[model samples]
Target: MGAPQHEDVDTVDVDLYDPGDGSIPVFRWRQAGQALATRRQLREMGLRPGGQSPVARIECRGGRRFAWLYRIDLAKPKLPMTLAKELALDKAMAARQTCPKCGRRYHHVLPLKTLGSCLECHDGTPADPASYVTSAPAHRLAA
Candidate 1:
């Protein structure tokens, strides 16, 4: 008998960083395989995890940074934006872009949290006329 010969085992030159404690497998950087995708990647593909748990993880920089990997086939299509959602989002943005003192809604976000009002109202800086709407409709979203 020569040195004990192991037979009937499949071997491949791939690094599977499994913790061996029954946890999900880990892969390095771009080694997570084509079937798996991170959350952001799924979103970019117009998909969502759809309540499915991650089956693996991909790490980089010596495991200091990692992202969960989900099966792309198990992902669901991203939800479509509805009229209600658009209205609610617009309302929220109005609160941030509208000046509290003059009620003018600027196209850009205002520093309300810091200065408590627009620059013109806070420090007498003359804002550009093209920067804001003089009078927004009272019920823009009304039918």
Candidate 2:
């Protein structure tokens, strides 16, 4: 086996970390393969070039939406996985709330500090976030 080869550095500014970097440099780059897709395409497939937001943005062109900008941080494995999990957890939080002691459930905006243990669990108990486990699966499915 030999060392892997990498393409020459492609220094396009990432969307989340960068605002617009002027269209000229981006336009002149001569897209090697098929050009990266528009945000619409990515949204349809649920893949963001930069990943998801709090770090991704919807960019517009000519008054119509163009593409998604992602943070380079999204490319980091740890952050991407964490974001995916958070998104899933947010969806779950939106879905329902639970009583940790009785396992009965309810619906409400869960307190951020009480993410793991529900209101019932922490009733007169210490709010030790470290001791709790999220109800979310260990690995969340990408939306």
Q: Which candidate should be chosen as best, given lDDT against the real structure?
A: 1
TM-score of 1: 0.47
Q: Residue 78's C-alpha lDDT in candidate 1?
A: 87
User: Would you list the clashing residue pairs of candidate 2?
Assistant: 50-70
Tens digits of per-residue lDDT, candidate 1, 19-130, equal 6444678788788778999999999999999999999877776665678899999999987758678999999999999888877889999999999889999999999999
**Per-structure clash totals for the candidates:** 0, 1
lDDT of 2 by residue, 19-128 (tens): 35433223212131233444445445555555444333343342133333444434323336678999999768644554444343445544545456466455655534
Name every residue pair that clashes in candidate 1: none
TM-score of model 2 vs. true structure: 0.23
lDDT of 1 at 62: 63
**RMSD list, candidates in order:** 11.9, 15.7
lDDT of every model, 2 decimals: 0.82, 0.44
Which segments of model 1 are wrong by more than 4 Å?
1-18, 82-84, 87-143
RMSD of 2: 15.7
Each candidate's TM vs. the true structure? Answer: 0.47, 0.23
